[model samples]
Target: MTFTRFVLSKRETTLTVVAGLLTLLGLAVVYSFPTWGGLGGMALFAAAIAVGGFPVARHAFRELWLSRSLGINTLMVVAVVGAAIIGEWAEAAIVVVLFSLGEALEEYSAERVHGALEGLLDLAPPVALEILPTGESRETPVERLAVGDRVLVRPGDRVSVDGVVRAGQSAVDQAPITGESIPVEKKPGDEVFAGTINTSGALEVEVTRLAADNTLSRMVVLVQEAQLRQAPVQRFIDRFARVYTPAVTGAAALVAVVPPLLFGQPFWGEQGWLMRALQMLVIACPCALVISTPVSLVSAMTNAASRGVLIKGGRYLEALSRVRAFAFDKTGTLTEGRPVVTDVVDVCTCGECPEDCGLQHAASVEAQSSHPLARALLAEAEARGIAVPGAQDVTLLSGRGIKGTVNGANVTIASHAHFDEYVPHEPSVCRQADELAAQGKTVILVQHDDEVCALFGVADTPRASSRQALAALRARGIHTVMLTGDSPTVAEEIGRHVGIDEVRARLLPEEKVSAVAALAEEYQIVAMVGDGVNDAPALAQADVGIAMGGAGSAQAMETADVVLMSDDLAQLPFIVQLSRQARRTVTVNIAFALGAKVVVFALVAAGLATLWMAIVADVGATLAVIVNGMRLRR
Candidate 1:
């Protein structure tokens, strides 16, 4: 019963169980028959070979045939034949066993790379807490839940759909999806995504999207979609192994046969030349070299998942290490997109009451126009609760500013360049205006009763982390550059704030692409990071495009090789480090594989290595390379 239980286990355990069973059976048979020595010997040999040779044969066959082409397996076959011709069947069998064992190890290592991403399929609940008409509660299948359904999400539960708070407030931990460690605070009308953990406080949420379109489904789809993409071209060694294996095997066959026949040498001797040829065949097995890369790749992936860096594949991993220059957009990449009013400037003084004059003139004139600057001024006035008097016969001068009459006072508030023609008297106001403009602040001049009053300064400020991240990147020897659509003054101001070394301003979309290409010539490799539609062209051209995936457009993410799961700039340095580590690992695995083969080749010619030893060497070499590559996961 114990023996039966052992035999019913998985493949990894079968070898031990079968070996024990064969040993016991052989012993029993030998005791029963006096001539059982020969029979027992054969049984022992078959059991040992089964425990050894079968695996190698299976692996070599799969690697040779299952592969897109037959290169490596053909070599192993030739080696086996040479051993058999020299009466080294046991040695040949051992070689096959070692080769197969190495192949299995490689497969297992490759499996580690994609071990994360538990399909959120099961996270979808069968029933939802739906608040129906008349405020009655109903437990309906999540499938029945549609847009606008108010789902009552309890504390410590995942939100069932992407929705806004129709009633209550709660906190949601979005780490599972966004890789953000902090739990986001939510309030009414705030859109909470599905699959995010509802941390504290129970809340009612109105679903704005169906279950299919929810974040959970989208994440699963994205991961799956990413998988369907092809990996970068296989590493060079693996490709070489394809042609190398078959050619080596064919040569070994010719060595074993042609030499014995032409030279009239006996098939088997104390030192069988055929045996030497077989050993030579065994020495050429590239299993270790081939398995080395995939194993490392898989292990690296598995480790990275634990840390929330869902690198799509090994190719992207390689590309990340090679990025030399990083291109960034200003509005969101380096600064908070939320702009606020900072200062006001006026070139012309509205005698005695400068404040009211500029406010009255600029607000009235800007109210007539429909530009962002105009809106900023209007919003500022509204926020201050200033009762803006009616402006009469407001005329918007195209490409300039605006003019009108506010409370019987002639008001003309325009861009500083345009206002120069109308308001001219105050040198202090002009200096203040120039200072603000130079710092990248948008300054709007105001003039009432033909006197300049004030200039409103508006600008998007840099985030606290942006400066720190820039410094850290610079410390790591990476050049930090800013690409902006703003004027040179504005670009310089923002560049100084963030400690960026280079700034490219006033670039059109096509120009940005050309700039990146030109820079690529001097730089080792470049990574383009941007959030807007204007950045699409350059992002596609980068060696490794790091898109701000959360705020990023679909086109940007699709074009980029590596997408920052969150807009965390700190992850930039971390990714670059990861790439460096992965590249080193790849090199190490390659070296290990090749080094093992070289040693085996020497041993074979020296006649110190047997077929069995060759098998062990091949399996050991393959296993070592795979394990080495997996170290990148660390």
Candidate 2:
């Protein structure tokens, strides 16, 4: 029976176990065998080889079996057999051992970098409490809960369905889905998503979506599908090795066979032809070249994970390094995504007002709801410690604004159209608000007695360091672009503020994917950065997708190759630089390893290098390349 466990769970402990075994076995073998290859000599190999070997053997077998072991392992077995048949047992053992060790190192790197998807899965809402025939609640696995099923979401619980709050009010840490840094306030009729934390308060929710269709499940499905569909870039090297092994083996045979008989040289003489061929086989293992790229990528990725970034795999890391363009989603990515009041306007005041009546009126109207805007206004009023009086006949116009009577003042909070009946804007405030609106700010109108009394300004402003990150990317020659569902006025405004080279506004989710596809035609690589539900498709379509894990939408963050845990953009440019550095390091290692093998093979053939020297050249060069690639973990 197979007992499977995650590779990362046991690496340190597993390595320790293997090392102890290897130290004992190696010591026993050396002390018992042909001239004790040195107890001291076995120690280093026991430490490096044993620790490096098990991982490789496991990975190679897993991949071979997963891919069905069809032909990938065939050529390798053939190469090893050919060498051993010709009396090169030690060389064959080294070849197999080296290849296995290399495989493990690559796997080790991957294990280190993976995200806590399993832990995230633990956040799935348990049995959803459904309304029963007798007016009581019945518990069922979320999967059994169907659309239109009324469910109860308690305080400090995760919402299980995507729907509207039929009753009750509360603040939700939507950070689970939206990656918004702060909590979002929710009230009756406001849209709520599943897999989000119910920070405070409780509510009765009408299930508008089935459990399978809930936002959390959708994200899980999307992420899994994307991963399955992603092409395995590392497999190309394996395929290359299969073809490469036979050809190299044939060359070594020709070097050993044809030349000796024709030149009247003895097969096992002091300048033995058979011996030289064995040296060629030992040097031509190709383990170093095959393992180079995947190892460093795995190492850096694991290192990133320990710090909170969640990159998908080696291919994404490779693509990220080659990126020539970077596109950002405006809200909850570059910006905080927590809408806050920035300005205030007043009209219809009969005088004797201490504060901006527009501000007070707007705040008063906004005090009744928990939307980002509602919270923004409410917070501002509260910060000023403005006491709020409960309103009567409060009516919510979803996707618009709300209306009610606050202390018989007949107050209304609305959009631009709603304000036209009450107050008129001066050129300066109008112009300024228009400018601010263009930059992605949300503007609300506060009305009193059929006149626009004040304007409340709100926005999910950019992180203080985003502009600087954009500047750095531009300097690196990567084109920076922005995409969003926000109004053109807002998108363009955000684009301008963040110094984006292009802005595509009012895009639906599908439109964002099409946009990324279109851009891929001209750009070498496009990295998408987003924060929410709207950003999911775009995140999947881009050549390289980075999510702001801390403040991005749940879907966006989970699907991204690179996730910045701090919800800040300052980490972005640094990630880009590190990726480039990793790629460069890999290239250098490959060049050094391959270049050395080619030169040494040529020397051994020309009789310029002795067999002992050949062994040194092969092992020495491979060790150097391996050491060089390990530098990426730093």
Candidate 3:
């Protein structure tokens, strides 16, 4: 900043500068004996006090008279008045200046974290290119955009609203929301969030949310709310200060009067106890104790947010530090949740047929169905270069199977339930299906008339990082459990693949909640990670609820105590490590602040600590606390 700008910048700076000048002029003139003598020195010191101490004294008076409060400001005012009574004008001036400087430093450290939050506001573009019905585009403020409006986002532009891509193909960087290092591919019907950059293609997006109602806006609101929450240690310090200040005041009063009266000592003598009382007041200031833990927590939260993990508040962060067990929902949390056909086995016992004949018949009928397993069958057939013959007179069998005529012969593709319910199959065929189901595959049988033709095996694939994350948590001695609605066989298969320590299968939503409560009872703190609406109850039941891929599910994001934006399991360990480190930092800071105060207060009571030593101990401890808290930012 320039000299002119610095002078005009902040009220604190302006006041500090003026008061600093007054103190320097008074000190210089008072020490130099060639000036207008002691009378001139006293007047200059009084002028310096008026200039430097007005704000502090006014605040102290207002708080005491209006709120009946005994704050640190009140302590400082009392000390300054006691110094003036002892004719220690230079000490009074120094106290006022140093107190102001210490407060400014504390404020600067606090604003540093708040400034990181303000950076979120700059991620979104102020204007958006609206697509008009007349086949033209107009630049419009994002605030004017409503739901269902169409907007054009060119390559390298930030998406201004949460919406669906109507037309486009490109990799959009979602690091701002999900913390994923890689850009995600966006195509027609894919969802996009606000503030993500469109990297390589122009997109026509139909906005599904208003400008103010997007995910980014809600996150900002959440972050602001988190900052306002106080940690347990911070609340303890606040309660301590409310009592400590008034107790210190009474002690200082007793030190100033009782000792002098009982010992028959003069009140204004060079050896008077007034100076000792003033030193105690300065040393007992709770500035360091009150600011330590909160600053550390705020810095930790801001740092976590920057890294793509959202910790709801200090309470959750504290609980996360103690988490000894982690429960994860199976689908979408540990696996891809998309079923794919893995194998096709021919078991036809009827008349001889072509090698891929059954698959060809299954694909022909599945191509017309919209079920997830049907799509998987069609995709597999397409990949195998098979031609699907047209089907006629298709009949939907609800949850059983589909029946249709492919080239004059009837083909039925059905689940095991269908055969068990209607057309009972041979023991060998049923045994083969059971064997496939035992291996966690969804078995679908294709029947040609009364004979089984082919069997298709499908399963949800586990993510590439699932095993590594589970192992990392296990290495940290954290118990890992999987909760899923799948059958016991299927859940066991998936849990073993991810190396989970425990697996609970066939769980209903209420059962999942009971499992979470059971874990909580076994372990003091447990965290649950899930992505679907069904996981909401269990999430709320856990000590800390973490949602995976929160970018897609608003309910998951809202319900979970912590949301991993990237939907990646790797971030889970990183979050736990960071939270543990933050908790350690807060502990160290509190220890340092209290330890320093105890040593200084003892010296003051023994009459060995000087006024200069008291000031250094108070202000220096505060600066150290601020610096220690800021280390989490890195």
Candidate 4:
């Protein structure tokens, strides 16, 4: 890389190098008194102070002027100036140099934490092959490609736009965007995101979003925003530091003056009270304590982002660690949102229905509707290779079912309630429907005029990982509850299947919010998990809102505090585990930093700590906390 790029990217490292070299140069001049005289040594020390102390003094004065408060930098500046006034030029130069180096290392540690997520910016290709109207392709910048433009992705190439596959087939590796290890099979009409690799076969994708608004770009933006937001612990430390710095400065002042004036103690010697005060000031910097919480939070957030979980801020991550209850939406959370036809019971005795069964007629009428149950019927019919003759004059029965003319006969598909209340149906068929409903299946009756033809049992099944994830949460002593709009029977069945501790059924969007609020009151900290849009109110009401299938929906990413990019319930357990670990790391870091400072302060009081020892204690604590925080990156 060029020098400019290196300096821009590794600014903290560069600062440390410059400050260290200047300090060493000053030390060499002072020690080599034979070649360079005492005057020359003094000049070198002054130069070192001028260069290394400039930034320290500048920052100190800037903060003093703008915030009307004294900071750690001000304490360092005062200590250095006092040492210089006492004719300790070498010590003053070394002190400033060490402070500068410590600050740079702290900044460098923070940069590394952010780098884990910022590296995602490079995953997407800058340009894409845009297919033109004349069946030709041109290399165009992704930014120039608008929505609805078709792009051709060749084999082994990364997809450059968030689009739908218009044609062709491929297994796209979505690890960069969704954290899915296995390559996802993509065919026509399936969504493909930017930064995903087309592993096999070529694909023609129709752009759904511009490059700037794509999933990868949005994730980077969110991660950056998350880094800027401080957790409660970090804010508390900041407040403590603001008060602690000035209080320590005052105490240092008393140690310097009160002892010599009242007790006739020496004030200028190597063991003077003034020197002890300087050591106290150096130990009082609080650099490590102020840095402890934020570094841990940033590292934890970055790690989460890398694993396909987007934590909005440190506040939410910290909140997650303490969550006692997790309220989950059943439809698209614990259970697959996509319902499928599971059972087909033929109840027709008239023998006037379709030869293959009434599935063809049901599919024919359902093809005109866009409901999820309609898709289930159509998918089943397509799977069975049953030809739909197509219905005409299709009329939606308004919250009941659909009615249409099929094969010169009136065919009506209705819900179980509608079937029993209006249409004449067999009691055995009704009993069969009850059995299916008891098993969490939604039964839709297919009728031929006045006679019931077939009972279709449609169900949205639980995700394969749902049981394991809930069990994991329960094992962690967290209460799991299912809050859904499905019927009591359906909700209870799904809750049992997923091993949820509680179940609330037949709830509207507003009711879900109330349920979450009640959970929060009982459990203290409750997390609501949903699809991010339909359950947005409940998600907002909870302490932490987690959205599933975030990679496919922008609403999910925007509505939830935490988003699992892939539709994986298993990530919930992983998030909880990571949050707890992050919390522990933060606690350990704070305790270590404060304990180090306290030990040094006691030593300073006992007249055992020197200027060099004080600087080492401060710098060493900062480094210790930084290393501990960075461990979460793994």
Candidate 5:
């Protein structure tokens, strides 16, 4: 480490130790006044004041000169000097020692909160085994590795860059990047992130992102930026401290001068007005009150980040706790974005059709399309060992479906709504489509010329954890709503399966924004959850915006106020509980800090508190609030 860093690392400990030793030596000399003589003891007291008071004095001078403000350090220095002027050398030295120790403890507690980011920084390894073009591997620094460079990862080694698996297979532990407890199975085509551990088998990964641009690096930078952003309550306390500190200084001045000069009050005695004024200054420094909210917020944000939840700032963390309504986008937020073919029914009116004839026709027509539902149909056909011939003269029918020529027959596949509006279908087929839609499946009709042949039921089902997540939210009395562009029947069925309280379907992007605005008006604090691209407008409209599966998408990470690194709805309730607990911690810390100061001020006014007792109260309260804020790290 550099000399500057070394000194900074040890500065607080050095200050605390130096002040403590001086305090003990000064007290010993004062107690042995008869043995050392008055001159020697006074000289020792002067040395103690110079040594123990310099740090506090310098800070006070800098703040006064630069900011033109009287801060907590100013209060401490004034109180210490006043005690020294009153010839209370022992009290002055002890006050300086106790105050230094309190500052040291507060600094240490703040460092512990920041240590979470340091832990994240340590996760990515600096080196990787780069595979050259000749198929031989050589150890190289991660910074030298470029995009498309292949790296060989051994079992039990950390993946050095975010990449896709090009060869071999393994079960990679993604806890560092995604907070997932179970190791994920990685194959040749699967994407793996940097900082994940290759747990089981050796693999070769093709790098997609450079070392500096990796997911772990981005997370660390964003977390550092997040800690710098203050919450609403923290800003309020800071402003309050600006006014409160100067007011206390003026009050201390009044207590020192008014009673002694205007009335018959002692100026230099043990219970004199000046002594009471020094005690007031020591007790009402505002150190604890000023620090209470920010420390709690930083600790909470770091804790959330470590668990795969990137809360962008203290403002969002505080807002998340107050969210009364949660608006979720349907496609990629609540359900698996990939639809699967569930049921394939043969509805051929002509008896000449063979078994599985409807699926073959639908798959052949959909094979040319890249849409999710088309993929589902193709996958079903492939799984059944059915062959699909390439279609000719294929054309997309706008938003409805696709039409093509297959096996000398004109094959057309359209959505259920489009089929009802434009195609001539039998009542039995309509009833079958309605029954399938009621089960949360999207229905697509397979028509050959004027005759309907098949009905394919495709559905993007809810995630396994969706029902539990919604139930957890409901248990917390948070209303859940689903806003989607899907048809009303399918959206409501999916909503019912997931226990949503309200379902708003057939919503355009702008309509989703309006729904979010309405929810914000009624609920006061609404959170919009989505894939973060299509729902960006609504997400920005709500009080807090949460994006799902941020680990894969840079857009999601940049767009939302909070990003869940993994596609786990369970993390939603976890972050909610964490945010609420953090808010409660902030409240308790503020209350305790202020209450302690108030009680100490009362005791000082009654002349029952001395300089040592007042400094102890002030230092004790500051340490108490720091420790309380640090509890969120657990």
Candidate 6:
């Protein structure tokens, strides 16, 4: 955050400063006394090279002898030695000085980017306000707080652990974790993550995860791991560099020996090809080409991670760039995954219970179940302050519904299809259920004994950002598909609302995987985005799997190739844009690096370029590509 923090370590800084001063002094002496031509001028340049170039030369020797590897350091040291042999001390000193300065600049830039990431880690407070059972609070280190420990988050304070709010209502600003623009309302039982700020009210939250296991910590770890992962192009460059350095060295040797020996030029004359060979050696360093893709990938990945997008590796970023279609799960992905009671209609004409008692009977029977529809019914009953009596012998009829005994009467809550089996004569109730199903609402027929009690309609609403996200994908010419266990009517209704191009409904977990495979076959690349345990299969089956981390299950996160650390669907488009930009930047860098080297190589071979010109071309190309790659970090 300060200028001093941007300064690198004292050792490196001192080395660079001392080397720069010596180079400047050497240049002053050479230019001021051009007629010296003796030991005096040679001593000045030699001092500069010894002081400024020793690090590079020493590294070159170590790598060459220990690992038998030829790299940029080897190229630089060889170029310097060849220049000295040809009595070109001024050029050698300048090359070493410029190379040293470039390394210093690279080190500073890397530190700055890493410093920005460290800022994210500092957002979490080291201590927490632990609430004690004796009605007292104590400040405790975050590391000592175990799971289930109660922590009180005061207004405007950052939440220190991931947990469900035990009490109190407040608006939490989750922008740091989810990139959400608006503050989210949280109350008892609602989940809140670490590093999120509590905007209003005091909240008592029971810790659900340890400090090191929080979402923010996981994001940082994943990004660090991602940076270490090599892309396909980067791996190829690594292999190429292994062969490239020695090949260029051989080419330089041939240039030094072949022309002077065969063409009969005086070996030690000014017109000799030895000088040209050294220039070619300097020009063919390949520093720019080797660094082109990785720097860009690192910058882009870090930037995306800071914005709540976790691209697991460079390969996934490459895959994301090629994605032509995206498949999404319906529940917990497109929809809110929480059903609300939409309509409660009267279907009881047999007078088994009072007309208004239909909801009470349904609520009483459903209170014993934990299904989504049952939760909706219980929630509605609680909101209306209706008393739900306890039920006995509650039984789950898998794929159908529940049957129980409530208040000494047999009660059955089942899907519309089973309504006829229980009440075969109730044609009127069946017709009403059909009408509600046509409107994309799930209808549950409530029966008391053999008589129809009521019909309950439940529907899960789509997320606010789903439509915009799908529209953005379509604008980019990428297809969007919806895969869900919901029936055709419900799936199509939600898919249409979200502008999805295709809908595959009533799919089991395995069927969802098949759907992703089919999409992959149709479009060479497919990305699947989901936020549930059931979605793990499809997510893994897709070419690129993206999980919504905020609401997603742990299994989905582990199985996904990329994790959107936020619930915001807008991250979908942002991810696509970032991946494409990274790929484009890398392509341009490769082309520019290779093209510049080829042009300079031609100039050097034809004796049209001096050693100074070769150094400028090589180092300048490297600096240009580095700056271009750093642009993504913005």
lDDT of 4 by residue, 225-339 (tens): 9878888888899889989988999999999999999999989856899988998999989999988898888888888888899999999999999999999999888988899
Q: Model 1 over residues 567-599: C-alpha lDDT tens digits?
A: 677777877777677677767877877788788
- Report lDDT per candidate: 0.68, 0.66, 0.85, 0.88, 0.87, 0.83
Higher lDDT: candidate 1 or 3?
3
lDDT (C-alpha) at residue 593 in model 5: 92
lDDT of 5 by residue, 1-634 (tens): 3323433578555755766776676666667776764556566666766776788888899989999999988999988888888888778878888887777677777767766687887788899999999999999999999999999999999998999999998999998888899999999999999899999999999999988989988888888888778889988998998998899899989999999899979988679999999999888888888889888888888888888889989999999999999999999889998899988989997998888888898888888889988999999999999988888888899979998988989988998889865568999999999999888788999988778999989999899889999999999989999999998888988998888999999999999999999998899999999998888999999999999988888899999999999999999999899999999999999999989988988997888998999889988999888888888877
TM-score of 1: 0.79
Considering only N, C-alpha and C atoms within 3 Å, which residue pairs clash in candidate 4? none
Query: Which lDDT tens digits does candidate 2 get at residues 63-87?
Result: 5677554232333354445544654
Q: By lDDT, is 4 or 5 better? A: 4
lDDT rank order: 4, 5, 3, 6, 1, 2
Off by over 4 Å in 5: 1-8, 28-45, 346-365, 381-427, 445-454
Over the full model, what C-alpha lDDT does candidate 4 score relative to the true structure?
0.88
Model 1 lowest lDDT segment of ten: 1-10
- Per-residue alpha-carbon lDDT of candidate 3 for residues 1-634, written as tens digits (9 for 90 to 100): 3434544476865676677777787777767865575667667667767777888888899889997999988999888888888888777877888887787778778777887877776788888999999979999999999899999999999998899999988899998888888899999999998889999999999999887878787777777788777777778888999999999989988988998899876566445688888898999899998998888999988888876778888888888888999999999889988898887888876658788788899989888899999999998889999999999888888878898899888889898767655456778877888888988999998877667788888999898889999888888889999999989999999998889999999999999999999999999899999883678889999999998777777776677788887778998888888888888988888889889989988887777877657877899999999899999988
3 or 5, greater by lDDT: 5
* Candidate 6 minimal-lDDT segment of 10 residues: 1-10
TM-score, cand. 5 vs. native: 0.91
State TM-scores per candidate: 0.79, 0.66, 0.92, 0.92, 0.91, 0.90
TM-score of 4: 0.92
